[model samples]
Target chain A: MKFSARNVFRGKVKSLKKGPVNSEVTIEMPGGLEMVATVTTQSAENMGLAEGAETTALIKATQVMLVSE
Target chain B: MKFSARNVFRGKVKSLKKGPVNSEVTIEMPGGLEMVATVTTQSAENMGLAEGAETTALIKATQVMLVSE
Candidate 1:
């Protein structure tokens, strides 16, 4: 599925770490850029997001307001 | 934002009914079609989805499997 969000990044699942509350999935973009997101375990399982899996990280442009260095 | 999902429907909020746990928001599409979705009240308020508001209902094509009448 192609999402229309302005900041669509095609990435590969670098790692999957399960936490007590939520799972932290990291995606590595083509240019060595990385994005970390928290999602429900069920969603992770449903999406079949695993290491080396190709996926798109979707975030509403508005939702991605700021970045802290 | 334009989404690239296979099924994209432009819809308007017809009604916003709040439940104790979740909110039931009904969206009316352009061709007199309607889709009912359940979302958290916080998400609704965050998205500013009020009656008469224009919004896009996003669901992964795979997520929308089938409908049984």
Candidate 2:
């Protein structure tokens, strides 16, 4: 399905830390840039996410925040 | 405040498009990479965001999704 998230990166699953409700999945990009995402444990299981699996990280534009620095 | 989101990039406001309820903001990074974000019009006004303004983009890990391709 097409997503409205502007930031989409292709990466490989580097690690998976599952909890009761949520799971933390780390995806390593081509340049070794790791993106950390927190997803529901059910979704993770549904996706059958595992180490070395190819995946794409999706972040919605509305979910993004701009901070003055 | 420190954020839990792993992906954080410093950029300058490239453009701003405002609607009745939401506003679309585009920030340009140092290397010309642009990140788009959708925020509430109230927030845009509260932050006093304008063109050429420097800012940081924040995204929560929980808000990120993983898609298998």
Whole-model lDDT per candidate: 0.74, 0.86
The list of candidate 1 runs beyond 4 A from truth reads A67-69, B1-26, B29-56, B59-69
| Candidate achieving the largest DockQ | 2
Model 1 native-contact share = 0.00
For all predicted structures, in order, the TM-scores are 0.51, 0.78
Model 2: per-residue lDDT, tens digit, A1-69?
A: 777788777889999999999999998876566778999999999999999999999888988988884
Q: Which RMSD does model 2 reach against the true structure? A: 2.6
Q: Mark the regions of model 2 whose C-alpha exceeds 4 Å error after superposition.
A: A30-32, B29-33
Report per-candidate DockQ: 0.07, 0.61
Model 1 DockQ class: incorrect
lDDT of 2 at A16: 97
Best by lDDT: 2
Q: Cα lDDT of model 1 overall? A: 0.74
